[model samples]
Target: MNKQHAQHQIWRKLGLLSIVMVLLLLAACGSKDNSTTNDESNAQQQEQTTEQTTEQPAAEQPGATVYPLTLKDDSGTEITLDKAPARIVTLAPSETEIAFAIGAGDSVVGVDEYSNYPEQANAIDKVGDTTTNIEKVTALQPDLILASVTMNTQAIEQLRALKLNVYATEPKTYDAVIEKIKNIGVLLDKQQGAADVADRMSQVKADIESKVASADKPSVLVEFSPGWTVGKGEFMDELLTLAGGTNVAQGNGWYEFDSEQIVKSNPQVIVYSSWYEEPNAILEGINARPAWKVIDAVKNNRLVEVPQDPLSRVGPRLAEGLQSLAKAIHPELFQ
Candidate 1:
């Protein structure tokens, strides 16, 4: 009875023990796999959350805010922009230039025929001239329109009726120009860039002021090619001040001065700007007149021909204009 029964019993106990050990090992492996899978899932979720968190700031950028902007322009026209403007259409060339400076040039979808600067702006569709072409502008379907109050007021009203935001520029002085830039920056949600530009302008203006403050004041005559003089608080007056010169036209705005006024004022420097490409015709008109000889600026050969495009534009470029005016008024100061 004993030896055979003992051997079978020992073998049966060993086999059962082996089966139990195999089941336990399989359970342990399953548990380990489950833990690894859960860890990987948690790691993936954390990475995704990090990525989303990082992207939120970029997505939170200010763009075309829905707020009101009420301000006056150079022409003393009170204009209101009731939201941050995206998708802009500018009627004035200088206003479009301001848009570019404020980092919203991409938003300008349409412009008037004169809005050419920054070069890339030339690619945008032209709404029309300073007058008419309302249908053309409407076709482009811009959300905002930047213009001058000098343009027909009815046009602004018409655009407004279509629920478009029309912001007008009316800068009376250099400070007002800075304000206009800031307003445009706020309107386009590019306030940061605008502030930078404004700061740069401030530095330049300060530098020019230092130079002008030291210079001898000369009598300045700023004339258009056709002999139209800007009298009194005007763009020419500002330019003359920057050049350390006294504007002969001080306080009368723009006017047609008789030849006698030119003789009587006895300006020390004469700066003429022509809207024409050559401006030779205007110069010819000036030289041909015997009355031009009487003016001190003319007799002294102080006639300077200003490069009309940049010199005439009243945006960020006005600093350069001031430099040009300084040179015209006092070439020795620049040298």
Candidate 2:
């Protein structure tokens, strides 16, 4: 073989080696690029998983929305009242009525059975009748639970265990009732309505005072179911005072006195109330008892029966109750 031909053959073999090396380098570069892309994708998926896990903690708690509330309760369990409650439940009719007056009736989820007024109250779930129903109340998931000192106490305690905020109310007189109404209004975010109601009540009181000056001041005896008598501090006593009458009873509060005591007092006028109207209902009671039969008011047939609406409801109509009392004391004065 010639020397030049041998040199040519060597050069061709080197060229073949160089081409194989370039192909191997390209294959290695592709594998590395694929590995890097896979790593980046896996990192992105892991980051998404972390964000999903972090979001779960936020879901565990309630959202940050504060409502305003003013809690006024005398004798009940302690509660952490942070803000106003949006949804409320009342275990007593009095509290429910107060809520209605404050314009928070729409937010009420449960009410006592005695809250039969306004017809809409019937649409809400019944907690009890002037009482409490713990299970039903808790199921409502109310942010606030309103009760009365004079109402069922056991259920209030049971509700507290469920971490519900409770407020108990007591209003013995007109002034206290106004204050209560205002506080309830604040709790339900009805400050304006409450103020208006209080202002109106004050005006009504002032008007009653003006009207009462010319009326005959009679001595009165108020009786209720099962022979209840009004004493000092009772709403009836307050009404009588406004109506220019003297409620002749002991202690000036509410009580159940013996028939002999009522007969002996011998009020100039006797007032009777019942769930229903039957003239004999009041007449027979006094007739059956000889002591009452001889009383001056009874002998003179000076007993009066008031309509169920104005006499029973202690809400806005309480002002009307006082007016009725004045009319009964002196019909000519009202005219």
Candidate 3:
């Protein structure tokens, strides 16, 4: 009976050991499954991160101008160039300003008398203004001649007759002016410089529009000369529109408006070019006019004087002109 009891206790101990071993094996298998799941999750996270990096967009780069490049001028005349022009002659102040602004100032060997904004242009040889000297232009032996279709009509014709490369421009709107600048840049192989100028002008325009978006557009009259005002289809007219003002002049292009017509329009803002003779006297004359006394601009003394070069020349400085007009028309928003 004693031997049987001892054998029974040994069997009980063996049973307990077997149960502990089984529990340990099950815990090992569970740990292995959990480790495998964690590895798979880590791999998936890394793959998604790589895909996001690969989907990023590349930065834009400036394009190179291919030579023997042929393009149409603002005058709608097609011109071809064998290579970048080394010697250039500008027949207008706007062209001179554009050439200099595009980093091709050194290439300008001759310029019109009015191209005086960049001190460098003033140092260059003067070709002509209103009427270009054909002999002087020929003597320069320019590879490229920049002219204005409107300002240098006869000069362009004469130069072209002489078998010279004359690229004429006549930008009527603000966007047209910017496009002209970019086009000039391409001709001069200064694409990056032109792009920079265009970007700045666009930024200024965008900023002004954003500021004046909610404001009311005031009635404005831009008198570059006595009795002379710009109407629709001109950069000045577009500048007024962009500056948040309504041009009071009637008809298209530049024209003379009678005192009676101006009185009827009754513009809220009177913007006159500084190029006018006796600006102070002119302002005084407008203020003293008894008929114009009822006009809001005259009554409130809202006469703003802007530099003629920036406003008149459809060049890089046109952006400056736009800002000045905006400040004059919407003083509160700018402030």
Candidate 4:
């Protein structure tokens, strides 16, 4: 062969070999891309499967309460219910509110005079207040008598003496109040309603805490009644703390605070309950006090008048009260 022809043949062979190598590389890259895409698809499928397995169905979840249920009250008294209470009577305002909140309103045969919320409760038979009329309650033929261990001690004893079922509640904290509501739901066969109320309360509390989490806790004084204040070991105190305020009241439970102590604490915000007669007069009286003029709450015009029922009563409306209190304490954050 001629030298030129031989060189041309060698060049042709090299070009063909290069083309084949390029084709093989392209095939390998395509295979790798396809494998990676398949792996990602499989991972997503597995993740979805895991999620499906972890989630429980409504049918599989806890349902209605079994019959003949027995439970203990806050006072540690054991009581058994043969069936859900068809007719119920509440001796305390808190218990009445809980019953109404938990969808047991229709079942409430009677309520104390102070159970004045929900408007419908006012139409119910008045069975008196903390000191309920045992005869009136008996006439209602209540299968369950809801009372407060602290507020309706005498009524509970009197009712139980007449062979009545009295479940008295005495929750000391905010969480305990929620638990009590849930227990009442079980007692009245209104579990779903109770859960809904509890969840709402929890959400309200969480939202309030989150809003005030970064803000500085201000010194606060809560006067639920005239010349009365709540301290540690009470739900009101917990509400104050949760609303991002440091309670100036010292001691545990309810107590009377004098003008001297009020001047000493010098709270930045003062929350007074409007339940007392002549709320405007009460505010005027506070403002007129010569020593209180030097106090920060009075000086800065931070005197907040709150409704008496929701805050003072340990009931479903307490969360609403907390929100109101939070707004009063941290108006800037709320606004």
Residue-by-residue lDDT tens digits, candidate 3, 1-335: 13233222211211101000111100111000000112233223222211121111113333455677666665667777888999999876777888999899999999876567589988999886545789999999999998766556678888899888988766666776776776777677886787788778978999998988888999999875445567765667888999999999976765556888999999999997663245453466566668998999988989998765676666788899899999989999888
All models: lDDT?
0.58, 0.56, 0.68, 0.68
Model 1 lDDT per residue over 1-335, tens place: 13333222211211101100111100110000000112233223222211121111222332333345454333343455555566888876677788898789988888766666779878989877535478988887777787664443567778867876676554546655665665566557685676667677767778878887877898887764354555554554676787688887743654456767778888888887544335355477678779779888778898897654445455776667677787788778778
The local distance difference test score of model 3 is: 0.68
lDDT of 4 by residue, 148-207 (tens): 665566787888899999887666567767767767776787867877887789889999
lDDT at 134, model 1: 89
Candidate 1 vs candidate 4: the TM-score winner is 4
Residue-level lDDT of model 2, residues 1-335, one tens digit each, is 23333222211211101100111100111000000112233223222211121111211321222242223354523344456577899765556666787688888988766565567888999876423667888888898887654444566677766777876554556555565565555456575676677677878888878877776678898664335455665455677788788888775444446777777788888876533335535445656777677887888888776543445344555666667777777666767
User: Alpha-carbon error at 172 in model 1, in Å?
Assistant: 0.6
Displacement of residue 8 (Cα, Å) in model 4 is 99
Cα distance off (Å), candidate 3, residue 321: 0.6
Residue 109, model 3: lDDT of 96
| Sequence-dependent TM-score of model 1 | 0.75
lDDT of 2: 0.56
Task: For residue 29, give model 1's deviation from the true position in Å.
Answer: 84
Stretch of 10 with least lDDT, candidate 3 = 25-34
Model 1, residue 154: C-alpha shift (Å): 3.2
Clashes of each: 10, 7, 0, 0
